[model samples]
Target: MNLKSSVGLLFFLFTALAKAQTDTTRIKSYADQVMVRMNLDTNIDQFIFTEGPEDKQLETILMTNNKTRLSFSVDYRIISATLSITPRFLPGNNDNELKGTSSYTDFRFRFFPKKFIQTVYYKNIQGFYLENMKDLFPDWKEGKDPYFQFPNLRVQSYGGSTAYVMKKDFSLKSIYTQGEWQKESRGSWVPIMDYDLSIFRNLIDGQKSKETQYSFGGSMGYFYNWVLGSKKRVNIAPNISLGAGGMFSSSWDILDDGSKANRENTEYFIFKFSAGLHIGYNTDRFLFGGKFNVNANVYNETENQSVQNNNIFGLLYIGYRFPPPKVVERNYDKVQKKIPIL
Candidate 1:
């Protein structure tokens, strides 16, 4: 080849390389938006220039990190199974604090001809929401606020759900769950009724209370996936979900006489919503990516009393894909000889 022809080829190669780099940067930018919103600790550069094989059909997606672990595999892209675990963390100056943890297991066994998918899931979560009470009394003097020490609060919840996915992007889910909590408050808190009774009344100061809630709810969401790069190896998906439910709750306070007092049992309502973004680089060998989710929940007992919870979190993970198993053939005559007559 002539010298001018060789120079032309080199320029073409350089241009293609520059375009590939730019696409990688764009995917990283989208990942950054989700991470920053949830305050997750991640390095974008570590993920941008990753090395992997060319894109192919992925039968499974597995990912894990300090806060979340997810593993899901499928058969013929129709029948699927998944396992996920999520842990809660509260940011602190020196080290992050563990707020809670939960486990989720599900199986998607039913598939309609071309339009629908269904999943049955079971979940159990145990944690506490400590931020609200802390914000309520930021500076409590030890002597003056003797009854106002930080609450030893704990919440336990378990539930199951059935989800239907339609057209591969939209989903409608219904869930039934039960939860129990031990809660307490002091320093003269207002009650949630027509009367002016407070939690920290003269009759019931520094008392611990027990509450239980049963709820049924449904959620609707959509997910969109974008593939970038000439080889279609990089993928990103952003999803949004909204849900509402009614809950039956019952709570009673402990009186100074070591007996239950002010027994109140009533039904309440709750609403929740969340938005998440996920990014990954998938190849024949392995997959790597991170997901960030921000969510909020509101609980209302009466028209005048309500509690709100807002939380943000995310996870980073790397996973490997296993090869499909080989099919085995059996001889009918040999099997019949080994069988005993009934």
Candidate 2:
């Protein structure tokens, strides 16, 4: 080839390389901006890509103008093209499967904007019980005990809870070993927290006393996906948490005339420890799961009267898993950034 022609070709190649590098840097800046807008600027565990076959390589990138969100994959796939909303409907027997009906609904929304997903939940329960009241107060006597005798003993509670789960997905490489075709399993460790407030009513004989409780806590756990059959998988997660809260009970007195009088409020500090096991089956579109939770609460009113409460419950839930939107990768070189930088 002539020297002039060779020089021209080299110039063209250099220009292309520079442009590609510039695009990589530009997309990264845009991603950081989206994180800041979503108030997740410091969260390193947030995932911005979708999981797929390793050979079917794709690069996902997020771009935002602070007001508008745009995302695309390297192969021009629409990684975050369309948004999806899934509403979870759950109804089941009481926590202990002892009696009563328990139900709750959750609404989930996802967006390409910081890959945001939000869940809002509300629950109403009646006649739900923890355990026999006699178990907590073992030294009960008809007239000698500080409390009066009742025909039946049980608890009724109703409350609402809200939680934020950081959006995340397993990448293909992390799901498999190097050069191995072992069925790639998906797993994610995300930050999850919830707040709950409830009113608990205790029935003694035929009379009623009420208490209000407030609790907030966070837990870290891994959701491991296992293939159960063709095109089907099961998700299992185990978690532990610790929390602090308080409870306020309204004091009431029963007169000799069989009348009831409301007294002042009695307050107690509550410390909570909980462990949960969750198992679920999932198709490409829907997921169904059963969760068993056990928690213990230590209540201290003073140095004299301290009590321990145990709660056990089972919940069944069903929801839809929306398809991830098309992804656009601007900088394919940095696609494998470590996630959940725990």
Candidate 3:
């Protein structure tokens, strides 16, 4: 389906399931508590382009130099938000001399209503260098020779996902946002819909080009949260999903005379796979966890050319929960009186 239609369908499904009955016997809610989290992660933003047939295929990998990110987040009631940045002080984040300078920024927000989860995010990434220089050049030396770089290539994406849990007793929140805890082990089937708009800009030899892509997809995932320990404070969760989608892309170039060239449009079928494992220790007031997640998308650009976008990340986080102050609670109550959704 198209992006608009996919979004409309997600809205309809969300409203239909908004009031779906829920059982909280196996879960514990922390709606009255404010959660603050600090996270350190190694998140790679990269893409691989392959051309020609399998035996004679040529591969070009583009990757950002900033490989680590630190983020801070706060969650209260039904709302959560996070801001992330890559700092040069980090060990692996400051190799600008070898990989060229790069920058990355991300902002995300999430809302929870009953069994439905809604998320929205924005990401900005620029500057990439060829990661496999040795394969391309037989005499290339890693420290002595500089790799090919795209100094003016930038990608920005706006995206979000909507999901609903089919099981009433399972706590998806426990595995994701940590807003709630599950007292018993359980599993659930979750159906999710995701949509995104991406803009790519590049400048080469004073010529500018821009491309825009729109994509949407639906997927079904199974999540199992295995609770352990006598105190029920330790858990391991693993989830996987497979999906298919479509992408519409359009591109145009700026001519030397300052005129625009004819826009080119292309459509492609996309295949997606995502899996993750989360292990955490949670208590009423303190929590710490680690997570590993990977997502891959493959699409053919032509009969002999294809592109793959691979995202892999590992995260470690520690958080604290406490009762919200009266002023904070009162303000939220006031906002909720008008919006009602919170």
Candidate 4:
């Protein structure tokens, strides 16, 4: 080839290379700006880039300039080259199941309507679920106890509950519990269920009540259901929690002679008070949780230890947490430098 022609070709090639480098730098600069605008300056876990006609967008660098999409979608995946952009948004939530680990701050509101999956005590476990089971009574109408007739008693129970998140963690939640015991004298076998369904609200702001808190010498909030922790391993993923609260309660004594104890006329005052302390380990399917709850009442009128009544209830339960999942962690590492693309 002629020397002149060769020189011209080389010049053309150099010009094209320089132009490409400039374009690449501009695109990268734009992506960095987009990240700054979105307040997501940190290194991303993984970003999916998209634009269309899909192929029309070049993979110039790690930086992408789709700032317009920062607010509308997650990341994009360009499947074509027509510039027909598909703004992919964050994960979709069907029912209450959310994708991936929600931010710590968002953990509270993200897992709402925490489904109630009660794992009844061993005695209450008639089958797979309480929902479907033959009426143990088969004919309780003719008898007294709904599940049975004569006098069957239920003793020993276990279970505790909490809000189950997508990553298999628990949060502020209402507990659950059941207790009953009976002895059959003659008639039939029956199940006894005695428990209170109540919400106790207390506040300790100068010994007063407020919207979300309560105070006194000490403060108390509304809660029921006590499930203590277990010293054993029962499932693949292990979860444990400790809960406590104080509130007013009553004492009831049931006599086999079909006679009730001296019932006290209730007044609008703190008649009795109690505390609940629980520790539990729950699995996605069965939560073998246990708890120890104590209720004591020192007669207000007279401070007499003998006159006061103190009772403790310990139970174990096997239930399920909603959106049951294996616990996971989303670790965030600060990005000081960009990783080179291989």
RMSD per candidate (Å) reads 20.2, 22.5, 7.4, 32.8
Task: For model 3, give the 10-residue run with minimal summed lDDT.
Answer: 13-22
Q: Across residues 304-330, which tens digit of lDDT does each residue of candidate 4 receive?
A: 111222343444444322321222111
Clashing pairs in 3: none
Worst 10 residues of 2 by lDDT: 36-45
TM-score for each model: 0.48, 0.40, 0.91, 0.21
Candidate 3's C-alpha runs over 4 A off are 1-25, 256-258
Per residue, candidate 1 scores C-alpha lDDT tens digits across 1-342 of 432353344344334433332211111111001010121232110001112233531121111112333434332222334444332432221112222222223232332223233334443322222222233466744333322212244334444444444432211110000000001100111111010111211222476776666666666754444455766566554555667776676677876687887777786566766555556665544556676555555675344445544444456655443433332113323443585220
C-alpha lDDT of all candidate models, in order: 0.37, 0.35, 0.87, 0.23
**Candidate 4 colliding pairs, count:** 38
- TM-score, ranked from best to worst: 3, 1, 2, 4
Error of 4 at 77 (Å): 36
Residue 137's C-alpha lDDT in candidate 3?
92
Which stretches of candidate 2 lie above 4 Å from their native place?
A: 1-193, 202-208, 215-232, 253-262, 285-290, 315-342
Query: Could you give candidate 3's per-residue lDDT for residues 1-342 as a string of tens digits?
Result: 532354354344333343342344388999899999999998888799999889999999899888889999999999999999998898898778788999999999999998999999999999999988998898999898888999899999999999999998888888888999988777778999999999999999888999999999888887777777999899877777778889999999988887779889999999987777788999999999998777778999999999999887889999999999999999999999999989
- Note the clash tally of each candidate: 0, 14, 0, 38
> Best by lDDT, which number?
3
Best by TM-score: 3
